[model samples]
Target: MGVIPALVILYFTIKGYEDYFKDKKIFLSFVAGLLAGFFSVLFESFVRNAGVVSLIVLIPFFEQIVKTSILNSRLARGTEGAPIYGATLGLGFGSIFIPFSMVIYASRWSGLDIVGLSIVTLGAIGFIFFHGATGIYIGYGVKSDRVW
Candidate 1:
């Protein structure tokens, strides 16, 4: 459920800028997003363990920086498709991040039936769009030589 929406957004985003990215760069950006998602989990765990009361406030800052780190690298900087690449990267990040989070929630909630799972999936889809939209903005910023 989560995967389908993410793929749809990815397909359309890439389709809109189909000529901008080669297969290799797209793949690399997606992989970077996945890595960012993984690291976010680790960082969140560390923060939780450290008893950080301001974690909720800090998450957005932490996530945006970590998630877009790859886009700020030299390879991405050289590309004319920075916006497309950033959106693609965010697609990858949200694809992994949302589903992993939903699964963890489902696991913890013993009474989560199909209805509950469906709700979570729906929420995940919303989040997928949010991530993709933010990525587009980030990419646009990069392309315009503006810091975000």
Candidate 2:
């Protein structure tokens, strides 16, 4: 149940630009994003009670750092397709993070139904796109030597 949505988003996210970056590097970035997602889940366990501030600031800050960590190195900077890699990395993160999260948190609902599942799926889509888009912004910054 949790795996399907991420896979769909992942396929569409990298379909266009997958050829621009090396398969190995793309796979590495995806893996890195997955690892970052794992760290995020760990961090969430600690900060789940910190209120809106933690949700608005700390988690995103951590996510952005980990999302760009692969590209921050000397090897990735000034590369030809920063946006492509960034989108892939972000897609990878979202693919696992959002679905896993939604499934676990969905239990809070009284009972699961198609409508409820659909809503959660929509949230997953939005967040997956958010990560992919933000990755592009960060990637461009890394490539151009300018932070945006």
Candidate 3:
């Protein structure tokens, strides 16, 4: 259940990392990924009780806004800025989830075994790709136009 997703997350994150390095925007990448993860979890949790629909619709918009903010903060004006910013934000969202997932797994497994812990870690990695892809799209929009 978990390892498969972990592999997925690893794949996308690695790709994201490559993009970050290729552009030589380490600071932006790290910060964006960190911020994405932080904000996604916060926003997701806050809206979780409200319902999945609300979370799905609202979170993406918020995600895009947050992503654009990061881009606007560091990079100079350019066409690629939006995409680049979005990618970094996606990475951030994915990276942060990894640890939280591990904790969640640990709690689930409590005193019986380590499977829960392992599962969470793997699951978290899977989530990384999901979030990363989202960031890419959101950032792409922000860069393409002043949608935000």
Candidate 4:
């Protein structure tokens, strides 16, 4: 479970380094992304209470907005490394956020429900990749001045 997220992070971090060298600030952005994920989880609990329609619509919008809020801040402005930084941040956010939720789900399993556990594990892996890919897109957008 944990290994998948770590690999995702590693893949993006390596890609970021290879494409844009010597940018240490990505680590900081990565930390911020983790915090963003934490806060988004907190915020989602509130949004989830609003009803199914809200859950289906608002939650995703809210998550994306909250996740990328840090990248859109003035701190990232004019930074030539914005894309790589964003990717790293997204990597951090996905790594911590997705696995933590899956761990909770896994803990709730009764006995050895391999099928249920397998589904949860697969979902986690899929989400990690989704988050990483989204982060890369957002990062690239920020880099090109096309994303707010």
Cα TM-score per model: 0.83, 0.82, 0.62, 0.75
User: lDDT for each of the candidates?
Assistant: 0.73, 0.74, 0.60, 0.66
Best by TM-score: 1
- For each of the candidates, the C-alpha root-mean-square deviation to the true structure, in angstroms, is 2.4, 2.5, 5.0, 3.0
lDDT of 4: 0.66
In model 4, residue pairs whose N, Cα or C atoms come closer than 3 Å (at least 3 residues apart or on different chains), thus clashing, are: none
Scanning candidate 2 in windows of ten residues, the lowest lDDT window is 1-10
Better of 1 and 4 by lDDT: 1
In model 3, the clashing pairs are 33-92, 34-92, 36-93, 37-92, 37-93
Model 4 misses residue 50 by how many Å? 2.4
Which pairs clash (backbone N, Cα, C closer than 3 Å) in model 2? Answer: none
Residue 56 local lDDT, model 1: 61
Model 3: lDDT equals 0.60
Comparing 2 and 4 on TM-score, the stronger one: 2
Per residue, candidate 1 scores C-alpha lDDT tens digits across 1-148 of: 3556677888877876677778787878777876786787667766755555547667667878875677778646756788888887887777776666666777889666878877777777776777777777777777776565
Quote the lDDT for 100 in model 1. 68
For residue 52, model 2's alpha carbon misses the true position, in angstroms, by 1.7
Q: Which stretches of candidate 4 lie over 4 Å from their true place?
A: 1-4, 19-23, 103-112, 146-148
Off by over 4 Å in 3: 1-24, 43-65, 72-77, 109-112, 146-148
TM-score of candidate 1 relative to the true fold: 0.83
